[model samples]
Target: MTTTVGRISLAVQLLCRAGVRVLAVAGSANQNWLASLGAEPVVYGDGLEERLRTRAPNGVDASIDAFGDGYVELAIKLGVAPVRINTVVGFLGARRFGTRSDGGMAAATAEVLAELAAMIAAGELIVEISATFPVEQVREAYAKLAERHTRGKIALRMR
Candidate 1:
């Protein structure tokens, strides 16, 4: 499971390819694309737990909380052990529940980069580039990002 999956499509793709049943939690706007990414979309809102339970009655083995906002608590409610739950934006929750929130720094090794490169080369990973901006248009690019969910990343090209 993962929440607020902005920088997480690759992880979802990898997990799905590995035969893991992934439940991607995000807003309703992200549902369709998420399904295409091979994940069961769980929209964030009231009764989310009920919906998840209905979909996976056996419960989830682990969870990745990318955007916090009570995601850690929700994972605990779903019977996932704290040790198996990794969070990025939920440091307080991690301290409270003992969920792992080591952040992306630890996974920035060369080996991980090699794996990502291989996946991209093999067409197994898709990184969506929403738009590209020259350095002069940096402000405009940021304005676009502030709009939220451009459906991809905004690239700034250098000369």
Candidate 2:
């Protein structure tokens, strides 16, 4: 399950490309986009676990948490093994549950980056650029990021 503005789109794409059935937990605004990437988009908030259970009755084999509020606990409740769960922004939860906190560092090898680059170059992967601003407008860029509803990355034009 994922949360809004958690870069969930990229995760969904990568997982789907790897043949994993992804059930994206995001807000309603992103449902169509997530579905386009082959993820089963489930609206987040309130009875999230029940929603997830309804979607995947067999149980989730693994989970990735980018939107930290107790997602690790939710994943555990859904029966995902702690070893198979990774949280990018849930260090506290990872510590409490023994789940892995493998974010960019764990998978940021040059080869992996190059592979992703190649995919993007070949049009096999789409990197959504929600907005762009000049470097001088860095504060504005961050302000937009702080809104937590960006559809994709916010790029800063250095040139």
Candidate 3:
């Protein structure tokens, strides 16, 4: 499971707390931040296959493709079960590979949303606020967020 320090990380953290062995891969250098949230952080670099081969020798339970760069097939090639794959990004190869996203089949219920909100409110999860900027400082806010080593969310106050 890969997640950013934004809203998604909160959910991933909860899943990890619920006994899921989450392998959280951050796109930026904030990998250690994810580790602090009880996830195995995967830093981006070379030898990815070797790393994955060592870490997930038994095959992954599922792979969530947040970047949507046709990782569903890549995950399958890595021996993850196809049925367990899901993607938030548009499927570019669905027609060619005949694989559909699992997300499309499920909808978030109000109860689920409330429970998640409760978790956040209770501080059972951590939300990273790396930086915040007013509307007038959009460029600065974007720069902070674009930083490779950012550890959390960067909020832009529009109001």
Q: Which candidate has the highest TM-score of all?
A: 2
Quote each prediction's TM-score.
Answer: 0.84, 0.92, 0.73
Scored against the true structure, residue 126 in model 3 reaches a CA lDDT of: 76
Q: lDDT by residue for model 2 over 3-87, one digit each (tens)?
A: 2223467778888887788888888998899889888888888998898888888778888888888999888888888998888
Q: Per-residue lDDT of 26-132 in model 1, one digit per residue for the tens?
A: 78888898899998888878998898888888787788877777888888998988988888778999999988998666888999999899989888888888899
Q: Per-residue lDDT of 80-111 in model 3, one digit per residue for the tens?
A: 65566666553764444555555533647888
Candidate 2 has an lDDT of 0.83
Better of 2 and 3 by TM-score: 2
In model 1, how large is the Cα lDDT of residue 41?
87
Candidate 3 achieves a global lDDT of: 0.63
Model 3 error, position 66 (Å): 1.4
**By TM-score, highest first, what's the ranking?**
2, 1, 3
**Model 2, residue 64: C-alpha shift (Å):** 0.7
Off by over 4 Å in 3: 1-8, 98-105, 133-151, 154-158
